[model samples]
Target: MAASSTTLTLRERWTRFVDEEMSTFVFSTGVYAAAICAKEYKELQPTPQRMQQALRKTGAKMPLITLSCAIGIAGMKMCILGVSRLREDYTRSSVLVACPVAGALLRAHRGPRAMAIGALSFGALGYGSDYLFSMWHRRNADAEEVRYALSLREHHNVHHNDAFFIETLQSNAYLLEASQK
Candidate 1:
């Protein structure tokens, strides 16, 4: 019972993993979409034939692009979480490299246009996740933290502005700093 209490169950861990993956799907898909859109709509006015070609290409590439995006988001989340521990996050860094590397690979097998999708996604999602999580922490008060640590650990749905997020992040940082002492 003691051991079980200390470690997360498989279901809990899987749920957390799934939560992170789903939260960032929009950014990942956006990355894929941007590249696909750009490639598909390069010309000022596209013909019906051109539209069909672009749709076909973009559709075929979406799976790989989405996979790469999901990979990137997970890597980014791991890096941020590791940073919270006040140590080097080598694992996150390594995992994150997969995003661009996969993109480059897509470029090799697909086209330059396909590569853009991955690269864009890496930039958009990688950089954007910091903001996404900051937004999450901002909305939840210290009460939320207490509930999660002592009670059920679930994400809060309420949201606040950037200022709130910054203030909460600062307060959390202070708490962390004090804890280290």
Candidate 2:
């Protein structure tokens, strides 16, 4: 009986891992496509014809919106998988990224000065809330899937803000490398 139970557990874990990885891939790709479309739309300038064109382009392009939605769904799935696996490292990293982004958004919506203070305050609060909620959900629920999904949602929020950071980091690294030459 014990051996059979162990085999079942192992099988379950494997399945979950596979599902999560698939989800991560889809989510990442979708977000990338969506971001590209958004940037393109923004660059076109706001006119009735341009707006209609943008909408048509996005709607007609299967690869664009479909990829984004797939990515989002996949991310949520991966989060659930992580939580179920009790992977604290992944969860913590996710929280780190999510908290600051949430704060920044809150700040941005409030204007310049409020943006700074709001970012700090909201970021801390967001992180704390995430931690507490994760803990609570883990204890109270049969599965931590919902908690994991929420974490992934937080991660998506951070992902949206990551473009500037990524670009800056790449530029700085290039400059440093050039200086050393």
Candidate 3:
């Protein structure tokens, strides 16, 4: 029995590692491919370059854009992590509270145009991803076979603050504080 349990754990960990690696690879590849395609299509405005020239210029921008996107995403995630640590029982709604503050700071450093674009993209990316994850989990939870198995799944520690998803981040400013009961 002990040997079987140990083998199960090893298999679970290997599955997780493979899944993570595949997802990372797919995401990076898709982002780079999209960026390259967009740039080539944009440059086609100038008398439609030969296929060779377009292909040559295409890959050059992809790497840079991919790196920039990775950095931006990492920075945003870091900020979200920081905010959750600062507040108790942080939720997705709580993160929205920091959007305006971020916008203001960005506006001051950049400009209104940048702030507007950044705010829209940030809001969409953050909330959309959260919603998608929730939907995936909900689907799993609703499955007859998964319900029983879920209990055996490992859960991450919630020592600092328990983060949850809410439909909107624009909930009342005092909501977190008032929800202690």
Best by lDDT: 1
Q: Write the per-residue lDDT of candidate 3 for residues 144-167, one digit (tens) a residue.
A: 333332332325433343232121
Candidate 3 segments whose C-alpha is farther than 4 A from its true place:
1-29, 42-51, 94-116, 124-181
Instruction: Please give the ranking of all candidate structures by TM-score, highest first, separated by commas.
Output: 1, 3, 2
- Candidate 2: where are CA atoms >4 Å away? 1-38, 41-46, 87-181
Instruction: Estimate candidate 2's alpha-carbon lDDT, on a 0 to 1 scale.
Output: 0.55
lDDT of each: 0.60, 0.55, 0.53
Compute the lDDT for candidate 3: 0.53
- lDDT string for model 2 (80-165, tens) is 44564665556556655544444444334336675567557756786788788776654445234334544555667667657665
Rank ordering of all candidates by lDDT, starting from the highest = 1, 2, 3
lDDT of 3 at 81: 65
Each prediction's number of clashing residue pairs = 0, 4, 0
- RMSD for each of the candidates: 14.0, 22.8, 16.3
Native RMSD of candidate 3 (Å): 16.3
**Residue-level lDDT tens digits of model 1 in 104-147:** 44344456786677577765675577566655565455445544
